[model samples]
Target chain A: MLLGVNHKTAPVEIRERLAFSNDPGVPYRELKAIPGCEEFTFLSTCNRVEVLFVSSKGDETERKVRDFLFAGSMSYDEAGKYVYLYKGEEAIQHLFRVGASLDSMVVGEPQILGQLKDAYRTSSDQSCTGVILNRLLHKAFSVAKRVRTETAIGSSAVSISYAAVELAKKIFGNLKGKRAMLAGAGEMAELAAQHLLNQGIAEVVVANRTFERAVNLARCFNGKPLAFEELVPELAHVDILISSTGAPDLILHKEDVKPIMKKRRNRPLFLIDIAVPRDLDSKLNDLDNVYLYGIDDLNNVIDINKSERDKEAVRAERIVTEEVLKFMLWLGSMEVTPTIVALREQAQEICRDEISRTLANCKDLSPKDQKSIEKMASAISNKLMHHPILFLKGEDAPEDQRRKLAIFRKMFSLDSVSRQDNGESD
Target chain B: MGDLLFKGTFLLYLLSTIIYSVFFFSQNKTVRKTARMFLLGAGIFHTIYLIFRYFEAGHTPLTSNHDIVSFFSWAMAWGFLSFRWRYQIKNFGSFVSILITLQLIVAAMSSSEVRELQPELQNILFPIHASIIITAIAFLAMAFCGAIMYLLQERELKSKRFGFFFSRLPSLDALDTLNHHCLSIGFPLLTLGMITGLIWSKQVFGSFWSWDPKETYSLITWLLYAAILHQRFTVGWRGRRIAFFTIIGFVVSLITFWVPSYHFTGL
Candidate 1:
């Protein structure tokens, strides 16, 4: 069933309005209210809002989902444009893309995949996913895997944290024995510091507005922790410096660093001013060997990585498309197999009963005659069913024949055959 | 100990470079893989050949202008091999292979006249310095890969074009981190190597900070990383800017190695 709202459907306010509440049992209650509903999963992230369900009523059950999303407090007219509906195959593909990070606000983000899995697990734990949803979720996992393996999208480094380390290596020919200072200890700064550590920068010092955040981030990246105020005094000790904070304007200006540069005897300092409104003063680049690059400058690296990895995108797309087609073929084949099984089992049951009754009625018949009668009945059933089952195996079988088989199963009261044999229905 | 092995390996690297360049432009995946494998094989053979030459002279192979340059290329090839082996990255190995091959070609051009091993080169400490220095450069080679990634990433963003190389390269953050991590490990190793070198120099030359071309270049390389570390920690420079400098620094270090040896008449 379709259940997602994005930038197209909802504004930031509306999306945030329908975002996940602290209440944990809301999913179960909402899903339980839908008719024929057997599964309930919701994936809510910064870029998307989704509610996945398994209901035989399908689109007819949309009203309940609508009510759950808006709580019927307002009209759908205001926010409906931002929503796109998907069902069956389309819905499955959407979920797969979402999980694979292809549909993410930032493509190739690894977080969405884990979030989708968590949502799915929550539904499963609440006894929401029935046979249909179970198959759908499993299929989503495979599609995600196929995307990851066949595409280079996931390999490129796009985030700010990685870009920081790349810059560090640039200023320094080699990272060996270099020292780094991470100021503000914002998640961004911490992440950047981690990248610095990974780039082979040995000594790392984290200084944050709050001492504890610095300590925590330092501990996470295995860097030496420092205090916030210690930044100015220790400025000369570091080779590369990263800063991110909530300060509205320039916390580090040319004035603050000019003296440090002089004291350091003109040794270069590569400063990464990553704050949105800008952290360091732009004029600081005037200093010799003092390379200051901003968040936008990181785009250059991001673009290049995006292209290099994009070269493999065609290969990955072909894989996903082929897999989807293969899945559809298997799904198509499944319909015929069930009807054939239903027909054969019914015919076999009748043969056994009739043969046993005949043997009982003729008490004078010898054991050899009875055995022969049973063998003959079995042979007739096998020979009768062989051609029909073989025809079902054809990938390009006639639609009329397929439909007729379905009608036969329905007429014979065997439409609800065992579902255990179903395979790869995406 | 003969010049033929050195020349032969140099030729092999040269051949691999052409093959890799062809594969890159032509989009020949099979040929690219083959060329990289060939480069790796050449590197292996080159290592054996260098070791034999080192033994023959009863000194480190990095003693002369010829062998040190050759060793630098050898280190780079080994670096490429390790990076490819660790990541199983199939396509980009050729880029670094070409670079390493060129390094060896330059080394081959330098005088390989086989001068007598000097008394300063007599100590076992000499060989230790050679190994550490080569190892440090090898790590830098991985850093170079990161730099290439950074440059490629920036170009893609500017052009608004994304392709296979675009995504295959590690993330801007990942590459930066990789560059940083590689440098961190390599820097310390280099520090120890430099320390050992200083101790040996002090014992032999009666001085530790002579500012020889090799020593000066090493300091400059160290200072470049020092600046990177400072900027990353103090300010927030990253990605392409960082990568550009990392690449430049490594290239300069390469030049420094070659230029100074020629002055010292290791050529």
Candidate 2:
């Protein structure tokens, strides 16, 4: 079963209230104390908090998990409005989708897969997952890999800072030796600068009205701090400039940039003006070798990329669906009763076939003789199957039982026959 | 033998161009490697063809229309290869191979008949002057290709609509640097070629400053490049404006070489 609140189902306020801490032990101890919670994994990221659990008392354990999630924050009735609960096949499908990143806020981002892997690792370290979850999570990982390789889900940029980095690559070809300057030290600017640094931009320079704030932001990036008044002079040296200052009017103008272009010998410059009222003049884009993108322009590019990503998402979702069916079949086969039934059915079919063939070969045999032969064949087949059935029915830990059932099915090739039967029934 | 070698060289260049075009779109590393090998083979075959033509013609092979154009293509092939040895510009070989193949096609279409050297053109200065000028034009041709690529890429960046050429082309900075490198070498060779030609003109024609059509056009092209180089050094004129000027200089130089006139014999 899966119970969770994601970006789509819960607003930030509710998600923040229900978010779990980074310490794996806290959730492990608290959730393990529930009356019927058999196994569970807690996953908490900025956008969602989910608990995937196995339980025998389904509704009762689900109630406790929900109450535990909302404890000290809200009543169970109020919290129910923000959470979604899935059971059985729906829960399996939901976990597959999450692992494949289809359920992410940005559907095709690659981080969710890593986050899911980290959560699974922590859960297994705490001895929180059993055989079912171990197999399910492994299946989810392979499904994610299939979606990644078969679809173009994670190729395009869907975020603002990513868009900026893409544009920088187009202009500079390589960002290894390039420098970026943040004019205002705003959140958006800082994010863009961070992305630039990640792309291997050699240095970052931060300048703000408050020199102290500039120093702090510079320390975070290990970049130089400059006074706000020196942003224009600094522009001559840097390849990219991101400005999100609170200034009401434009800080840099076309006239101001023309001289800088001469000073820099006309190296390409990429300017990002993310400020609301606009810090850089619109005419800066008119200068030779200068590329200026405002917030709206970057958003427009991101919108285009988002649509492209959405087109790829449709194909990824199909892969997830196909994988979910395969996983569900595997999950169904994990039951010992089905394996035993299928094994016995196969032995009886083979015994009946041999007895009929033997009866046909001995044309002169009496009806009583033929019946005896059939009874003897049935007794021999039962004797041959008795030890295997006993092994399958032996009392063992659930994990060991699942392992034995898997091995027994493989030994007899029972799953293939069952699959053929399924195909015929369909 | 020379004709067969020339044909083989032409075929090699065509094959190289085809492979390079494939690599441009596919961006596969092994495909690029194969394309470079084909290009290297073509360059070597062209060199052999040039040597064979010199032996068969009983003089320097750059005297005829076909020989001059073929030599121009050969120079371009080597110039591009030499650049590849030093630095890599993205998808640069694709464009340059096209240019070299197109020049070879033009050379093949013209008459390959070898003619006796003219009385005035039989001096040592003839081979020296013609080879230098053709070599300089090869580098400028590379600049022309770089300029066109720059314009295509800059338009994509400016319009904010990234189409086919956006990722396939090199960065604006790289393209601009290409133009600078080509010009830095090409401009000085051009100056040297002109000085050698002037000294030869005085020796062969009795006057150095006569305004023949080729001379006038070469002067015009030279002045244009000089101005561009001057502006680039002093006032930092680059990118779009320099690309435009480099393109114009190459066209004018081509006209100077191709337009038939009476003053330059056998050209």
Candidate 3:
């Protein structure tokens, strides 16, 4: 059973309220009292809060889990309006999609895969996941890997920092040995600088209103801190300038950037202004060899990247569907095989008893005739069970397969074997 | 025998060109690997063809339009393969292969008849000069590819449309770096080749600075490249502007190499 509320359903207020504040290990402590929950794993992220658990009384367990999470503030019916609950096959499919990032708000984002792995790992360490979930989660991970390798979904940059880096690439061609200047030590600007560094931008210079803040931010990234007054001079040496200062007025004007472009010998300069009021004059973009992008531009790039990823998602969806079917087939065979085997064993045992009784009574028959009679009896039972065995193993829809399996077990009185195979007896 | 090898090389290049186009669209790892293998195979056959032509003609095979164009195509393929081996830009082979095949087709259209080497072309410096110049042209061709990619990728980034070409092409930084690397490699070789040609001209024609159309064009091509290199190092001229300059340089080189060789007998 899977119960979760993601960004698509719940508002941030509700999600944060239900989130485990500090300890991710709190679920196991609380789940100890929930009866019939054989295994449990809780996943809480910025975008989602979920619990995947194995329980014989799935409906009751879901209610209890919801009550525990919402803490009497909401009932199951009210929660059902926002929360998604998946049982058996639906739950498995949900896990696969989540692992593949198809269920993510950002369709092809890579973070969900790693997050899923972390959730699985943490749960396993806490003894909350066992044989079934262990196999299922690992399968989900491999499916995610396959999706990543087989499609171009994760190839483009879709975030602000990434978009800035991508724009820098457009202006300069390659960032290797190129220098980047951070006009403000704002978090967004710092993120863009880090992205540039990862793309092989050789040097980073951070300039902030507060010298100490600049020094602290620069030290974190192993970068150099530049004095705020030196921003104009430092622009000459850097290929990219990311500005996100909180100043009321513009920090850079056309006049300030024109000379820097000249000093740099008309080398391309990329200006990324992430600040709301915009740190640089828009007219500075008109300078030759200068490319300027504000926050809106980065968002546009992200939108483009997201749309491209959405197209590739069609292919990824097909792969997920194929994997889900394969897992379901494996699961179906797992649940049905023991009952089929038990039924066949019962048939064979009855055939042997009937053959033994006939052979003992028919003393006049030759030893060869007695053996032929036993063989005939065995063949009759095998022929009778052949169609049933084929039906048990054949490809049917999940619902139809379940119905047939239940009927097969009841008809043959094989509930004990089925229950044993399921590791449950009720 | 040599003609058979030439035809084999041409067919292999054609096959590889198609495969590379597929690789570009699909971006499949297996298809990329196969396309690269085909390019290598074509290069081998092309090398053998060039060697056979050299042995058959008893000189470096840059005497006629057909020979020189084919030789240029061979150089481009070899240059592209070396770049790919070093940089591992798998998508780049699509563009380079198309350019190579286009050159080969132009070569095929021209008569393959061997022409007698003119008196001034017979000097030892002529072969050295021609070899270096042709190799440089190959590098410039790669630079041209990089420039085109840079412009297209830049457009994608600026417009935020993120279309098929955007996904298919490498990053702007990578393309820019490729363009820069190509320019650096090509410029010096071209300079050396022009100097050698000047020396050869002095030895044959008693003048090192003749204003022949071909020589004038070579000078123009050389100056354009020099300016590009200068601006790149000093003024920090890069990306779209540099890419455009490299493309213009390639066109000028083509005209200088092709037009003068067909119309003029000697330098």
TM-score of chain B of each: 0.83, 0.98, 0.96
Which run of 10 residues does model 3 chain A get worst, by summed lDDT? A417-426
> Residue by residue across B1-267, what tens digits does model 2's lDDT show?
877898899999999999999999999999999999999999999999988998888898998889999999999999999999999999999999999999999999989998877888898898999999999999999999999999999998888877899879988889999999999999999999999999999999888878888888899999999999999988888999999999999999999997765676657
Deviation in Å, model 2, residue A148 alpha carbon = 2.4
Best by DockQ: 2
Q: Calculate DockQ per candidate and list them.
A: 0.07, 0.64, 0.33
| Structural similarity of chain A in candidate 2, as TM-score | 0.72
Candidate order by decreasing TM-score: 2, 3, 1
Report per-candidate TM-score of chain A alone: 0.60, 0.72, 0.60
Which prediction has more favorable TM-score, 2 or 3? 2
**What would the per-residue lDDT of candidate 2 be over residues A1-426, giving only the tens digit for each residue?**
999998789875677677666565888789989987777888887678999998878899999999888875888888889999999989988998998888876556677888899999999898888877887888888888888898887667757887898889878878999999998855567667876786798999999999987886787679999999898998899999999999999999999999998889888899999998999999899988999999988997788688777778888888878777877887887898878888889999999888888888899998998889999998999999999899899998665777788788889988785456334221
Local accuracy by lDDT, each model: 0.69, 0.88, 0.80
TM-score, every prediction: 0.52, 0.74, 0.63
Per-residue lDDT tens digits of candidate 3, residues A207-258? 9989987886776568899889999888888888889898889999999988
lDDT of 3 by residue, B190-243 (tens): 999999998998998898887878878999999999999998887788777898
- Model 2: what TM-score? 0.74
Each prediction's fraction of true contacts recovered: 0.00, 0.83, 0.57
lDDT of 1: 0.69
**Candidate 1 lDDT, A91-198, residue by residue in tens:** 766777776777754456566777788878988788776554665677777777777876766666656665555555444646778888877745466556655665
Superposed by TM-score, candidate 3 places the C-alpha of residue A110 at a distance from the truth, in angstroms, of: 3.8
